[model samples]
Target: MNLLDHIASVAALAGRPWHDHAALAADEHLRFEWYRDAVPRDEIAFLRLVLADPDREMAISAVLARIDERARSSIDFHSWADRVEPVCAPVEFLSRRLAEWRLLIDAFAGRPVEDAAVLAASDWAQRKLAAVVDGDLLVLLAEHGRTRRVRALTRVPRPARPVRLSDRAVTSGPIRPCYG
Candidate 1:
């Protein structure tokens, strides 16, 4: 289905609640230890569960592949792809990498982990891992660039401050009226 469903499935398999998995983000000051604690096992096992579910597995795989391609080409990943990388593809790839991993998980109704499939997924995931992990920085840079460019292109001059007139100037009456 959607991301939340995928994460919940994985979390359930990990013996953790959906809420804990739902809240993780790189930008969050969360530690990797927190993730390790939540999953409480090798990363791959978590992935097999997601892939085992037919609902969003292919979609997640496609997203991961796309992200990997982007990375190989040195393109920046967007926020959505970044999310998929850690929770979806990376774990899924690991699951597939271990030969018996498929059997173990699938026996529990987990998806069968194919070596080729997982390896391919892993290759792409690893290749793009840097980009996925650093996607926030790229987003920040892009936002910063837009801000700077907008400021430069449409800058308005600041209003000049006015000088206060001396009290004498205000007090001095026009010498005036020569009896005119």
Candidate 2:
């Protein structure tokens, strides 16, 4: 499965509507099981190295180093890096770092990255999944029954468009204001 699919599956297994801490913790173990069963052993080992590193920058640098090494050796670096990136960040900050690294890789390779909207949406989803996996967000959600609204509030707003008035001849002396 692709990275997004794997993320969705884990999120679904964690909870519906919202995640609870207990459920998230359980899902974390289940996620490992799924990764073991589905992903190749070598990839899993690489993932472990990435996730085990406490320093987010170091973890990202390590992944980039591997990508460079693989590229030099004529290996399928992009395919492998794609899978490893999501797993490297089990936390929100690290996930942003991962996204930044991804963009940097794309720029360095002269490959066009996805549009800003698409990238933002993907990053948001990844952050939510990471928060669920980390369990802290889930715990907070569980503690406050109505906290689901907080999630809605936290969502990134779309950019507002500038309003433009049409230049048209008016038959009346005064223009009537219309409210939607």
Candidate 3:
């Protein structure tokens, strides 16, 4: 589907009304090209609104992907970066970092983790990445990730253990975590 159609569909999913494309566009450059290209200005406001709702992030991300594909092909990205300073740096850095990390992930796939090495590497990477992507954001993400892992681990049933009496051993119930 074309960009506006995709935008409309996402907006519809969010129960948002169609908005004018002109208002939602990034700048006059994009707007002028949109007009020059005979792009319709009606019914595409969800681009702005959906950004405010976390639930629509995936859909918006898809739309942004399409927009990115189009923008890279049609617009002067460096010019846009000049207007929106620091725009390209994070994306460029993260893209490079993600590529680097993907190789590590692939190498580690299906392999047993070496805990001490993995922990040390993770600590170093987290510290480095925090410098690039804000320290507090990394902390919040790490905390969330740890919480999820802990919760998942807590839910798994442990094998039953034996309780010993004076002369007999009896199997006890599955051990579960006691969470405060």
Candidate 4:
């Protein structure tokens, strides 16, 4: 899917030149496609997932790690997608995309490959995702309601374990369902 390709593209940037603070206006290093499409969809879908199964944290983190592995792999996206398409039935692909977004954000924040902070970031990310879904109303306020936004962000619990993103996690390992 386009989201996967975008993740691969952004993940590849881990090896590219870094830009100055003045150069990044929105604090987002990802492509415009991510902002236009994936971000909201990701939040909504993930919120729905959390609402459905709040206890699936371990499984979600594991799947997200696998996704980060895939995005960071050297293999072509379509080729890998084709191979795993069969194994990833129903909602597997969707979850994989969400995982990609999360890891991509982390990598840009200097948490690439493997970072201990990411271990703790997972919890925060989860809480943040849940808050956005639960507090969608606050988002309608002017300027996205700065006070409300901070409240939402501050309330998010930090991650217990950061999702792992290895250099060759996918290409060197057995391909399997990256369900989140």
Top of the candidates by lDDT: 2
Scored by CA lDDT, what does every candidate get? 0.39, 0.44, 0.38, 0.39
TM-score of each: 0.22, 0.27, 0.21, 0.22
Q: Candidate 4 local accuracy as lDDT?
A: 0.39
lDDT of 1 by residue, 5-72 (tens): 75566666666673554564221223223333443354345544534544344534533443344333
lDDT per residue for candidate 3 within 63-175, as digits (tens), equals 34434443336434434323322322234432333333432332334333333332334443434333333233334435442345532333345455665565464448865
Q: Residue 112 of model 1: what lDDT?
A: 38
Better of 2 and 4 by lDDT: 2
TM-score top scorer:
2
| Residue 45, candidate 1: alpha-carbon lDDT | 55
Off by over 4 Å in 2: 1-41, 53-75, 108-110, 114-180
**TM-score of candidate 2 against the unseen true structure:** 0.27
Candidates sorted by lDDT, best first: 2, 1, 4, 3
After superposition on all CA atoms, how large is the RMSD of candidate 1?
19.9
- Model 3: clashing residue pairs? 19-44, 19-45
Lowest lDDT 10-mer window, candidate 4? 134-143
